[model samples]
Target: MLYQDHTSVVCKKQIFHTEFILRCHYYITTFDLYYTDQIQQTT
Candidate 1:
C-alpha cells in the first residue's frame, strides 16, 4: 500500500512537470511568432 501511494505521487509529480514545461514552451513559441510578425509588418 505504501509503495502504491509513493508511485502515485511520483506519477503526479511527473505529470505536473511535463505540463509546466509544455506551457512554457507554448508561451515562448507564441511570443516569438508574434514578435516576428510585428517585425515583418514594420519592415
Candidate 2:
C-alpha cells in the first residue's frame, strides 16, 4: 500500500512538472512575440 501511494505521488509530480514547463514555454513564446512586435513598430 505504501509503495502504491509513493508511485502515485511520483506520477503526480511528473505530470505537474511537465504541465508547468509547458505553461512557462507558452508564456515565454507569447512574450517574445509581443516584444518583437513592439520593436518592429518602433522601427
Candidate 3:
C-alpha cells in the first residue's frame, strides 16, 4: 500500500515537473507499467 502511494505521488510529480510521463503510455496493462506496484492490484 505504501509503495503504491509513493508510486502514485511520484507519477503525479513527474507529470507536474518533467517530460517523463509520455513513455508511460505504452503500458498496455497496469502490471506492465513502470509504476508496477502489484500490492494494490485489482481484478
Candidate 4:
C-alpha cells in the first residue's frame, strides 16, 4: 500500500513537470514568432 502511494505521488510530479515544460516551450515559441515579425516589419 505504501509503495502504491509513493508511485502515485511520483507519477503526479512527473506529469506536472511535463506540463510545465510544455507551457514554457509554447510561450517561448509564441514570443519568438512575434518578435521576428516585428523585426521584419522594421527592416
Q: Write the per-residue lDDT of candidate 3 for residues 1-43, one digit (tens) a residue.
A: 9999999999989787655455455444554663566544752
User: Which tens-of-lDDT digit does each residue in 3-43 have in candidate 1?
Assistant: 99999999999999999999999999999999999999999
| Shift in Å, residue 17, candidate 3 | 0.7
Runs in model 2 lying further than 4 Å from the true structure: none
Candidate 2 residues 1-43, lDDT tens each?
9999999999999999999999999999999999999999999
The CA lDDT of each predicted structure is 1.00, 1.00, 0.66, 1.00
Clashes of each: 0, 0, 0, 0
Worst 10 contiguous positions by lDDT, candidate 4? 1-10
User: What TM-score does model 4 achieve against the real structure?
Assistant: 0.95
Off by over 4 Å in 3: 19-43
Residue 9 displacement (Å), model 2: 0.2
Give Cα distance to truth, residue 25, candidate 3, Å.
22
What ordering of candidates by TM-score runs from best to worst? 2, 4, 1, 3
Better of 1 and 4 by TM-score: 4
Model 4 pairs whose backbones collide? none
Q: Regarding TM-score, does 1 or 2 come out ahead?
A: 2
Q: Is candidate 2 or candidate 3 better by lDDT?
A: 2
The most accurate candidate by TM-score is 2
Question: Candidate 3, residue 28: CA error in Å?
Answer: 35
